[model samples]
Target: MKNIKYDFKSVIDRHNTNSLKWDYFDDDIPMWVADMDFKVAPAITESILKRANHPVYGYTVVSDELYDSYINWWNRRYDFKMSREDMLYSIGVMPSISSMIRCLTDIGDEILIQSPVYHVFYYVVEDNNRKVVENELIYENGEYNIDFDDLDEKLSKVKMMILCNPHNPIGKIWSKEELSKIGELCCKHDVILISDEIHCDLTDPDVYYNPFEVSSDYEKAITCLSPSKSFNIAGFQSSIVHTKNSELLEIIKTQLHVDNSDSTNVFATTAVIAAYNESEEWLNQLKDEIFENKQIVKKYLKEELPIIKLVECDSTYLLWLDCSALNVPSKVLSGFLRENQGLFLSAGIDFGKSGDNFLRMNIACPQKLLKEGLGRLKAGITALTIIK
Candidate 1:
């Protein structure tokens, strides 16, 4: 393993494999969904194949090793200690979010979410019969900042709040102090905080994620972490939920049982065990490569498309592009790119109304494809600016 290069550059054809990222769009470059285009680590493939070779795909029981790997990984990377009893398993992170929402809040309760966040957070909030109260992030001078005064006011009324750490779309990694402050407000206001840390392992090279449980106010917080995003095994439908509030944890457990939302496929257990224990080197190399891809985006935006400003991103593979200078709504520009150039990215409006002039690009692919996407983006933006 001394001089061997990890294979993040080779583009794999995912057309016929039922890939959500590839198959969801028709022939266009699919940069919308979060799953990476790179193949998983060799260790993960070996584990899955080894399991496949076994004859019996019987009922699966998650073992203590599964819990241990999760704990060890968090302790090793984030210095957060988690106990086996505090760790719970759910089929998917989004489902777990819904289950917790239904269990913790009564009918017509309000859940807090920051605007211009991951679109799914808004979807689940409304879909679960709850009202969404937005504490929109402050965007000024080309950077996004937490609006503490607004958040404090919002938390005072809501029964629960869902947070995306290393926030999606914006890709801002919240510092320990920032997380503690949020945790403090939630604790003081008798509000429950559910954190989606699924993107924790995908940070840039020197950046790290702070698990919400590390704060003393964590008893009022619940965090969901997944190896699916980092390892690209989202189809496995496996995620871990860590909550320090034992009483609230019991309620979530009961709701999951009632909803039957806690089962993992046969390979999910093995994949998690392999991902946290044996995939550290692969992940480290991935972060460095992603950081390089981000640099390409930054340089391309500055030199080729100076009208669009790239927000400073500290973590996650998402690059938030502010296109207000182009004087076009993001939805219109998004349609133009998809129709004219066959380029598809998450429309900024999908995140929230405040993202009307923005777009989110996924840079977790090979450099060749990254450049290709950039070319399409530049061509599309130039055409739109001319039209305007």
Candidate 2:
């Protein structure tokens, strides 16, 4: 393992802390949720501590320093220049997405999403009384590719399209050309494009994901960004939306403001500023750790459980494992693993029907926990095979 300045191997006990990943299940190992089990950057904790030392916890305002932190981080890292005027603060990416769904589309309007994708894309559209049109990506030879023809056909029927760049579950990073084609199709169809890029900063070490706006000159695009996934400060509930279209921005701002999703909590701003400005090295180290965890899973899967295939991906710590060889549904397999081995991984069917043959495993934990999870997985699968 590479030497790291921060603690990534502590195996901190989260059972009684009201952690969603820990307390929600009786499973001994949870490789389910996207949040990292690693400790946050020292600077983030220090900033929060400094703020908490104050006597009062009151409503907070979004600071210019907070905006600059996001601006500088993007400019330095992705060469994506964003102005403060074009950006709007939100409590989270999902709330802002839900707000956009409510305001931008009419009842029964169709929305496009690529599958298998982040599961919430299904909820936000259907729950809002809008229809979902899936342009399922073509999966071939252990890789995922955009079906431009299908996307073009689907865009003609939808009012809006939600894109998951450096997508979750699959962990694939959409390329520049692919994003350009998507933008062109959306423009041709006059469809609104919402790019969920919260996972933009979690790529493999030295690998970078292309921001949607930077990859395409589509004016109808809204890019949702957050440091929560990258810096593991998700509990802070801070995110922002960037769009170059002033008219669309105004409409979105109004909807978010009306929905109360634009307000910030006391520590969200502090965490964002510290994460973007003072925690670059910590993020770099995290990328390395995730990379190592991926390698560990790959080696273990190949050696001990050749029945399961690890999908090839370049971004996000969430890994999509192909369990097609087991001839079992992902939901049943996931349940069996949890019941028999106390290992909880996400059932891929939750993302989309196309994902029923796969399982999504979150490997953003310490090596010790990752190894234990793998052990449980192997045990569960071995028993399942025996039953078969």
Candidate 3:
């Protein structure tokens, strides 16, 4: 077999494709979005092409073979076995969260979430007229941990909890012990756990991803998985909601029909099948590249820009920069980076109240671009220090 070469140095122009990362600004380097600057796997490209060759695009149902691909992939990658019957198809994790919230909980019910999480979690709860119970994560020793004591207190009123596994922004691959504690608490409180494992596949080889439902205590939970983040197929909009709870699954499916959300495009299924079936080699190479990129950021921050520190991360290509030492508001820092440094990143405040003085940088670009962005950041920080 030929070794797959994951070259992350070839910069491609993505300016005119109406991409949110590229088209949002003129002549700005977009390191804000989580999407990577890599081409889709050859397998996925070929599969889409094969499907496109069919002259007539007609209504289609998800094939059993596609479902098996997911089951097989999970078993092999995460060592978590899932039954075909337990899988439910969805457009994406966010939509599934919205639909699950609407279906499983009543209006005015409370939903719990950890602050400084994916910002959309707040909106997903509030948009459905549910109360958001914020349990802020504890940041100490350069890592973020869930406040289980506070979570226990909040669980009294919360009917559901949305968890981002291999968490966004900070890129934490939550330990099994941590997940066990959460599962025990949620089970005791009878809170429906909605674990979003969308970034599970992005983990480094040494890190472990404990699927919430993989534990017996957490079998009552629902897990959201997708090929979008791992395969760079976000535009395709394909995701799966896995659950062992038959009753909850029925409720979700029924509500999806009632809400007119029980349909998916043909391309999504095609892409998912190809991604899960034949993209492992590409994925392994991508993970290695991301790991190297992450080290580059860490080394640069520690040696070159001592004031700007990176949060601990074991997964995901996002690097959370702690700019608290700079003593500047995150938005101002973001603006300065974009205007003065030509670097764009997501402001910390956008994540939540706890994310102040932090900035999220996407390191999933070509190594050259990643280096340039880091160089600009280092230079910008140096200038700031000199001015101060």
Candidate 4:
């Protein structure tokens, strides 16, 4: 057994603490939400404590340290260099994305997204009154690929498109060739490209996450990211948006103003800086735990629940489970797991129609909790089979 330096072996109860994942049910173990169960890095907690001790919790703003931290992290980790001028801060990635959507497209204009994506992208597109034009991914042989031919056709009609690299739910890290093809189609069709690279840092070191701005094909693209996902600081709501397009940047700023999503919470700036600047070692340790959890799921499913297939995940702690072999709908299966087995997993249907017989399970937790969840899952699926 490999020695893990992190405290991923112990179970920590988050119940009754306003934790979205744990507060849902008293008995149900939530392997649903993307948030993790581990305590944040020491640097992050120290930074927040230092801020909390300060006399004032007044209106806060972005600083050179905040921008510099983000810029430095990207350059240091991914070798994607950018000036402070290229980065813009927003309350959160969703807010930034929603703001950009409003600014880039007219109501009823189409926004393209690959289906079985992050469920929020669907809401951000439709809740803003824009039509959802889905180029559903092709899932076969336990792998997923973009249907670029379909995407190319879809691009002709949509005015804007959002791409999720190191994708949520599916946990796919998009390759440069694949991304360039999409960029080419978007640019050729005059579509505003929005790349959400929030899961970029969660991938293994060798896996390359191509930031849109780094590619000449995606020169006109707008990329949004945050340390929230990578650092487990989603509550801070700090996000960064970058693009070389000056006009698009101005439009995004105007929309952010209209939405009132430009300012940071008092501690967000502090959290971002601490996470990016001082927590790389912590993050590397976190990724190891995440990957270990993935292995647990893979081994458990193969040995205990042979019918369920774990998708090939390159990034993110979220594991996409293919329950198609169980011959149950995702909604029905998810509900069964919650009700019968005390296991709460995200219903795949919420992502899109392409997500049939699939469930997205959050594995960023103590190994003990993951093992418990896996046991419950086997029981639920077995019960379903008996019912049939």
Candidate 5:
């Protein structure tokens, strides 16, 4: 481990802690969920402890400092300037998306999402009684790209489009030209664009994600962001939505308020403030650890398991493994890995139909745990190959 300051090498036990990834399953290695296994930054823990010592855990107000933290962080890190009035707080990104679905589109409206994308994008649209329209990404030569013609055609049918920038599952970071083109297409189709950028901060070291920048004429874009994914503080349930359109912002604020997602918990502000202000060095170290982990997986796959191809990724700790050569469905492969080798991985089918030939593995743990996961993966794949 190159990072001596941050403790990313500790293998902390999370079993029986009401952890969705650990307690909900009996698998020896839980590599399905997106949360990191490493502990949060020292500053974040100290801040939370200080807040916990306070007697009253009552309803808290969103302070100017919280907004300033976000504004300063974005300006410093991404060079993206955000106004205080343009941001709104919510429980999480999905909740904010759900509220936007209710406010912007009517029931039964078609919502567009890029497939082999985040699974929750499907649920938020369908559960709201809206139809899902997929602009399937074109995967060619082991890389993924936007099908602009198809996206343009589909945007005409859908009332809203949810874009996963620095997209999940595949971990592809969309370029600036791509973002500008998407903005242009959405504006042309008069579709409301919701950019889910919760994973923006988890990019490779010195490789930044491009924020969706809309022209002045385009006022239909909304961005949802959070420190939960980067800081491993998802339990706080805090996220913020940003929009340059004043009218749309007011409507969303009302919708979130009605959905009971506007208010923050006592510790939500504390965690966010510390994560943005003080935890940057820890996040930098985390990126280093994740980069090392990716290398470990790459070497293991090349040396021991050549059939399973590791898709190139620039962001996120989730590794997309192309298992099409196995001649087995992703569900079966993932299930076999769990049942036979006690390793849990997310099935690609959960993302979309196009992902059926792939598997998603989370590698945000210590090197010790990562090696164990690789060993289990090799064992499971070898056994499956023998059976076939």
Candidate 6:
């Protein structure tokens, strides 16, 4: 058997290529975007190259083999079975969510979301003229939990609910029992559930992530997933939507027509297949590296910068740093870090009202870069303390 390798020591320059994360600032280390800095798996690269070898690129239909690849992947990795008829392709999860909001609910309807979530969910709801109902997550004992009572109270008039499994920003992996309760609540309320499982594949091996529809109660849910985050293929623009309910699936299909969403890029299709079919070893290595990075951040914060507290995380390379102990506004602290430390992070307020004193850090870079960023952060905080 071949050994796994996750050597992210080599940093490849990504600037000057219209890369949003890298080109956002000059002489700044970007630890903001969710995308990783490591090279894609060799299998994905080989698949893209093989597809590129074709001289002519033309409009194409999704093949049965492509659907089979996704099906096989889900069955093997998550122990969930899906049929081809239940599958649909989209450019990405965000676009799908935006369209689904419009399709599943009418204008002026309410959409429920957990606060301090991925910011895009808020935009998707409000941009579609739907009211956003925020159920702020409860943070205690260094971990985050959903406020189900708040959610149930708010769900009284909600037409749809967006769930972030293995949530973003705080990186809490929702367990099966937790998801079962959510599924039951949604079903009781007769609300359409849009479950985003994009970060499901990047979790630590010890963590457990449950698919929403795996439970009998959540069968009416529409679950979105992709290999983009797992294999560093966000630029490829491909994702899968699974729904067992025919009526809901049809509505989503109709919305696609209304929005003129027809197809995905050819390369993205090939890349997803390769990633799901042949990148397990690489993914395992990447998960280990990410866990190591998480540990390093915890150790550095505890020993070097005890004032900064890390939120409990079990999935994704994103870390939430609580800086309320410093008693500084998050935006002001973010500015200070960017200007003095040359470090870029996603400001906490961007997520929601509950995230004001926190900052989201992306630890998906090489170790050297991670270390340098932490060092600069330590220095910057120490200087701030001295001046104060």
Provide the overall lDDT of each model, using Cα atoms, as 2-decimal numbers: 0.89, 0.94, 0.86, 0.86, 0.93, 0.86
- Over the stretch 1-388, how does candidate 6's per-residue lDDT look in tens digits? 1475646778878989899899857647889989999998899999999999999898867677778988998888778899988888888889888989888789999999998999999899999999999989998877789999988888777998999987998998888888888888888898888999999987886665777777545766899988889999999888878899888888888887677664877787888888888888888888888999999999999999999999978898999999889887888888888888888888899899899889999999989889998998898888887877
User: Which regions of candidate 1 deviate over 4 angstroms?
Assistant: 1-3
What clash count goes with each model? 0, 0, 0, 0, 0, 0
For model 5, residues 1-388, the per-residue Cα lDDT tens digits are 2354999999999987899999998999999999999999988999999999988898799988999999999989888889999999999999999999999999999999999998999999999999999999999989999999999899988899999988999999998888888988999999999999999999989999988853233578899999999999999999999999999999999999999999999998999999998888899999999999999999999999999999999999999999999989999999999999999999999999999999999999999999999999999999998998
- The TM-scores of all predictions, comma-separated, are 0.98, 0.99, 0.96, 0.97, 0.98, 0.97
Better of 1 and 5 by lDDT: 5
Candidate 3 structure quality by residue, lDDT tens digits, 270-366 = 9999999988888888888899888888888888888988997888988889999899889988888787888898899988988988999998899
lDDT of 2 by residue, 69-98 (tens): 999999999999999999999999999999
Q: How many backbone clashes can be found in candidate 3?
A: 0
Q: Distance (Å) between predicted and true CA of 169, model 5? A: 0.9
Off by over 4 Å in 2: 1-4
Judged by whole-model lDDT over C-alpha atoms, candidate 4 comes out at 0.86
Which candidate comes out best when scored by TM-score?
Answer: 2
The regions of model 6 sitting more than 4 angstroms off are 4-6
Let me know the TM-score candidate 5 reaches against the reference structure. Answer: 0.98
TM-score of 4: 0.97
Better of 2 and 4 by TM-score: 2
Which stretches in model 3 have alpha-carbon errors above 4 Å?
Answer: 386-388
Scored by Cα lDDT, where does model 1 land?
0.89
Residue 67's lDDT in candidate 6: 84
lDDT of candidate 4 over 258-284, digit per residue (tens): 988888889999988999887888888
Clashing pairs in 5: none
